[model samples]
Target chain A: MRVTFPHMGTMSFAMQAILENLRLEVVPPPPITNRTLMLGAKYSPECVCLPFKVNIGNFIEAIELGADTVVMGGGIGPCRFGYYAELQQEILHDLGMRVNMIVLEPPQGANGGLWSSISKLSVGQSLWHVAAASYFAWHLCKGLDGVLQSLDLMRARETVPGSCDRIWNAAQKSIGQARTYRALRMAEKEIRQELSTLSLHLHKRPLRIGLVGEIYMLLEPKVNLHLAERLGYLGVEVHRSMSVSDWVARHLVPNPRARMHTRKVHEAARPYLRGFVGGHGLETIGESVLFAEGGIDGIIQVLPLTCMPEIVAQSLLPSISQRYGVPIITLVLDEHAGEAGLQTRLEAFVDMVGARKVHRGGGVSCAK
Target chain B: MPSKIFLGLDVGSVSTKVVAIDALGHVLARSYLPTQGQPIVAIQSALREIARALPPGVPVAGVATTGSGRVMASALVGADVVKNEITAHATATLRVLPSVRTIIEIGGQDSKIILLNHGVVTDFAMNTVCAAGTGSFLDRQAHRLGVPITELGELALKAASPTRIAGRCAVFAESDMIHKQQTGHSLSDIVAGLCEALVRNYLSNVAKGKTIAGPVSFQGGVAANVGILKAFESALALPIIVPEHYDVMGALGVAYLAQPTAGQTRFRGFGVVAADCQVKGEDCDGCGNRCEVVGFRIDGRVQAYWGDRCGKYSHVNYLSVGT
Candidate 1:
């Protein structure tokens, strides 16, 4: 069966690896563009978050490209994401597009969990083969995240303009083409070495800003308008509060170390938010506080408009910003968001934080 | 010998403001002209007026552009510095009042509130996805009421008791104003109500959750309306300081910024006032992105390209004139 899935940053590499290893033909959805957003918005219910619209857009594009089966992750929360798959399926059906949907939901009590879901997809493959494929995919996911994390740091200090971006594009291409675990590891090492050794403005101490928000908005460059890259270009060191590997480690895998980190994050958030408001709401607050205490100059919260959890997080962020004396800016993005407006806001925000840093007697010059 | 002067242009949605400042930040010449949906024409005319006002052969030391059309203006004029209006506004306000803590800027299409601590911007918020609380809405309301926009403030100040109007949405606000008028409310009261409604909208939306501390300074095109200024004062319960060059503050601010860039400026002479410049937008169907690439042409030769998500079109040598 030909399978397709929605794009979420570099998670596609892992998804591609898993499907290709399982002897499945994978039709990767086209890179998100204006047309994708338009298609998604046209099909999606008005007022749903931007991610949903983008997902619908992906499905339509993939379907047109001969993708008959769709694989999507499922969630259980106060956030609208939990019901997206079901709603999307109905919408596609209504549009007279005949496609089979396989939802990989979080393993609950009785329904034979993720193993059975994987088994369903790997019909003729041996259990051992499936396990090996999963292991390779997981490693690739971790490798990609590592490369990206280092790239974020390198982007701010790269002496040559657009050099970091060029390296990153090359890295993504190499990693995507790497079939074996050894090749993947080699690709990761090469990219990391290139990033670390790249010519940089060593003396330029850039403003450190932490990005905390809804997972989709934080991960999707198209949705957030390449916020991290923009900030990096503005000479701000971007620290992403969440990553795909982090999500997989916490949710998909039963990693005790990941659980320990999650527990610490929850404890940090306990003083401000007691329980989960769903969809990374508590995580957003926790990360901001942590970032502030970690001596970050600023915090930027990016979320799609009409996002409930982020809206709640946004309301509480001002208090955190005030308490920690870190400047915070919440960017609410939607289809209507203009690039010019975003650029203006980002520039102003950088200026504000830079000035604040100088005011605090920090010896860093505010880069214009 | 004529002194070197710095020129700053603010190409806003409604108006284009040009200011020529000497080395000491003294305004040598200033001109304000309606953008009238043609920023290029407005910029040229404003420059022409400023050229007329300045002494003959006074060389421009540097040039800077700000406001919504900043990029376009900079491309057209070969600006030394292109900055956002927020920074420009803050710089100017701080120059006027060093101890200023709050700035309420309501422009043609957008409104912003900037909160400062010790001359550094502590926090700021701009109106998002809505123009309901901006000067354009007020201008439209004034037009519907058969009053010149400049006269709106004077008429509003004459109201005995302002009528209540909805400030949530521009459409609703207009319908509510019409309803209040049909119900026999006086024109002055309705006008006064609009000023109050817009102020309320601005506070609840753009300035939401932002602490508006004093000493407050109000500036922008709308700041010229004394009625709106009074409404802002009453709503915030603080006396607002309106600087002498309030309308041209953004241009003035950039002009001050341009002072440092003197002698190394890319100030393509005052000849740009008569240069034939045109902008054209074409949709690139090369990929799914279909970026609407905008090309800036001077004398029918494409000088620059922008608005593409990918740098491909922007980087292409569109410079060859006859190609």
Candidate 2:
């Protein structure tokens, strides 16, 4: 059976590896573009968040590319994401696209759990085989996330403007083509060495900006309008509060380190928000406080329009900013968001953060 | 003639402002003209007027561009610095009133609140995805009421008891105004009601969660409306300081920003007033992005390209023309 899934940043690489290792034919959806957004919006309900629309578009494209089975993740929360897969399946059936959808819901009571869903795709593969593939895929994802985190820091200080971006694109391409676990390790090593070789301005202390918001918006560059890259080019070091590896460790894997990190985040958010407001709303507040206390120059919350959890988080950001003396900006994006307007806001925000840092006697060497 | 002068251009949606300032920030010449949906022509005409006001051979030491059309204006005029309107407006306001703490700027299509502390912007907010609380709504209401747009403020000031109108959205505001008009409210009261409603919308929306301290300054096109100014004064309980060049503050501020780029200026001079420029848009089907790349041409040679997500088109170093 040909299997397909939506793209979420570099998560596709790890997913593709898992499917290929399981001996399933993988039809990866094309890289997200404007066409993807337009196609998704055309089919999606008017007021759904941007990620849902984009996912619809991915499914359509994949179905057209001869993918007969679609894999989607399920959630149980106040967020609309829990109902997306079921609604999307209905829409696809109405469109006369005959496709089997396997939603891997969270391993809860009476649910067949993740392994049961995987077994359906695996067909005759043994449980041992499935676990081994997952193990390799998990490690690959962890390594890739580490590379990306370092790249974020290096982008701001690169001696050459576009060198880091070039290295990143090349790394993604190689990672996609790597077949074996050893091959993946080789690619990661080469990329790490290549990144270290790129000359960077050592003395330049770039402004630090933490990005916190919805998971989809944080992970998807197209949805966020390449925000991290843009900020890096503006000579600001970007730190993402969420990543795929982090998500896996917190939710899927049973890791003490990840649990400790989650507890710390919850504790940080306690004074501002006590309960989970669904999605990443609570985490966004928690990360902002952590970043502020860490002495970051600024914080930016990126959320899609009509996002409920983020709306709740957005209301409390002003108080946090006031208390911590950290400037914060919230960008609400939708299909109608213009590139020029986003650029203007980012430029003005960077300038404000730099000026505030300078005024506060923080010697930040701003490079234009 | 001043030995070194700087030029600033603010090409907004509704108006285009140009200002030339001397080394000491004194205005050498200034002009404001309607953009009227044609920014290039408006820019050329504004520059021609400024050229006429200045000495024939006076050289512009530096040039900067601001406002919504900053990137396009920068390319068209060879701006030494391309800055956003927020910074530009703040820069100009601080230059005039060093101790100013808050700035309320309501322009044709956008409004912003900037809070400053000791000559640096501490925080700021702009209206997002909505134009309900801006000057365009007032202009539209005036047009519908059959009064000249310029006379709206004076007409509003004539009201003894202003009526109430909704200001949550432009459509709602229009319908509410129509309902009040049909219910036999005086024209002046309705107009005055609009002024107050807009101020209320601005304060609750754009300036939400912002602290407006004393020594507040009001600038931008809407600041000219005396009725709105009064509403602001009463709402905040503080006198609003309107700079002498309030309407062109963005242009004035950018001119100040261009001061440091003295010796090496990219100003194309007054000659750009006559330069033949054209912009052509074409869709690139290289990938699914289908970016609508726009090429800026001067004298039949492509000088720059923009609008592509990937740098394939924009990064091309085409030979410069008319520099």
Candidate 3:
């Protein structure tokens, strides 16, 4: 069967690798652009967040390209994100596009777990092949995250604009071409070396900013207008508050070693927010307080417009900013967000942070 | 070898302003004109006016552009610094009132509330996707009442008791004004009521959740209206300081920012006003999203491109001819 799925930044590459390793035909969704948003908005509920619309667009486009089965990630309670897969299936069926769906939900007590979904996806594959494929895919995921972390650090200091992006594209291509876990490690090593030795002058002490908020908006560059790269261009270092690999470990891996950092973050978040209001709501508060205590220059919170959990977080952030003596800016993004307006706000925020840095006797340092 | 000056241009949807300043940020010359839907022509006229007023042969060391049309103005003039209107307005306000914490700027097409602490902007909010409380809506109401925009404030001040009108949106406000007028409400009271409605709208929408402190300064094209000023004072219970150069403050603020703290300027010279220029818009068919990219050409050669999402056409080597 030909399988397909929606795009979520570099996560798509890992998904592609897993299915292909299973000896299944895979069709990756097209890169999101204005067309994707426009087509998706046409058929979606008016008030749904941007990611929901984009997912529908991906499914429709994938169906058109001969993909019969759609694989989607699953979430538990509170946030509307958990309902996306079922709602999308209904929408597609109503539109006369019949496609099979498989949700890779984490093992709940009665749900029979990841093994059932894996068994279904592996279909006619051998047990050893499935185990090997899963191992390779997980390593590839970790390797890609490592490469991305290195690129984020280097992109801020690169002397030439868009150089890191070029290197990153090449790295993605090489990583995709790797057929085995060992080859994936080799590709990661090569790319890491190239990225480290890029003949660009590094900024001595760049202004560091913490990025936090909704998972899809943070991971998907297209959705956020390449925000991390844009901040890097302005000579600011970025520390993302969350990553998909960390989420996978906490929710799907079922290993004690994988959850230490998230557990600590949850404990730290308890003082300000006691319970999880929804998707990443508690984490947003926790990370901001952590970044403030960590002496990061500023924090930027990005939330999809009308997102319930993030809306809760957005309201609480101001008090956190006040109590912690750290500056925070919350950007609520919808399809109607203007590029010029967004750029102006980001530029002004950076200027404010830079000024504050100088005021605190912290000029650009060569401490790295 | 004479000491140099800097130039700042604020090109808005309804008006264009120019200010020239010396090294110490003293305003040397200034001009304000209606944009009239042609930003290029408006910019050229403002530059010409400033040029005529400048002391003979005093070189402009640097130039800055701000406002919604900043990109177009920058491409036209080769600006040394391009800033957003918020920064420009805040800079101008701080210089005029050093202790100022809140700046209420209501321009022709938009309005903004800037909150500053110790002369640094801490927070700001601009009216998003709405025109209920901006200058254009007031202008439209003025025109419908057969009174020129310039005299709107005076007419509003003459009312003894103003009528109450809905201020949620422009459409609702306009219809409410007409209903009051048809039901035997005087022109002055209706005008006064319109002013109050705009102030209500501005307070609820733009200034919502903002900690507006004392020492407030109001500036913009709309600041010239005494009625709106009175409405704001009564609504917020704070006296607002309107600067002498309130209308051209954005240009003035950008001039302060454009002045070189060190190093030479990248000023393109006053001669750019007379250069042959043209802008062309074309649809890019590189992908399914056919973005209408605009190309700015000087002397029949493309200088820069804009409006393309993917940067495909814009990033192409244009200077190499056959490339």
Best by lDDT: 2
Residue B146, candidate 3: alpha-carbon lDDT: 96
lDDT of 3: 0.82
Per-residue lDDT over B1-323 for candidate 3, one digit per residue giving the tens place of the 0 to 100 score: 23778899999989999999888778889999999999888998999999998888777788999988887798788777888888888888877777888999999988989888755677777775566879889889889999999999999999999999899999999999989999999999999999999999999888877778988899998898999999999999987899989999889988888875324665667887787889999878765346679998777877777776544554453323221
TM-score of chain B of each: 0.95, 0.97, 0.94
Q: All candidates' TM-scores?
A: 0.94, 0.94, 0.89
Models ranked on DockQ? 2, 1, 3
Give the Cα lDDT of each candidate.
0.87, 0.88, 0.82
For lDDT, candidate 2 versus 3, the one ahead is: 2
Worst 10 residues of 1 chain B by lDDT: B314-323
Q: Write the per-residue lDDT of candidate 2 for residues B180-279, one digit (tens) a residue.
A: 9999999999999999999999998888888899899999999989989988989999978998999999999999999988998877777889989999
True lDDT of residue A133, candidate 1: 89
DockQ of 2: 0.45
Quick one: RMSD of model 2?
A: 2.6
Report the TM-score of candidate 3, chain B only.
0.94
Docking class for candidate 2:
acceptable
Q: Taking the candidates in order, what DockQ does each have? A: 0.44, 0.45, 0.28
The segments of candidate 2 whose C-alpha lies over 4 angstroms from its true place after superposition are: A108-111, A362-368, B282-290, B308-323
What's the lDDT for residue B129 in model 2? 75
lDDT (Cα, 0-100) at A166 in candidate 3: 70
lDDT for position B111 in model 2: 92
Pitting candidate 1 against candidate 2, the one with the higher lDDT is: 2
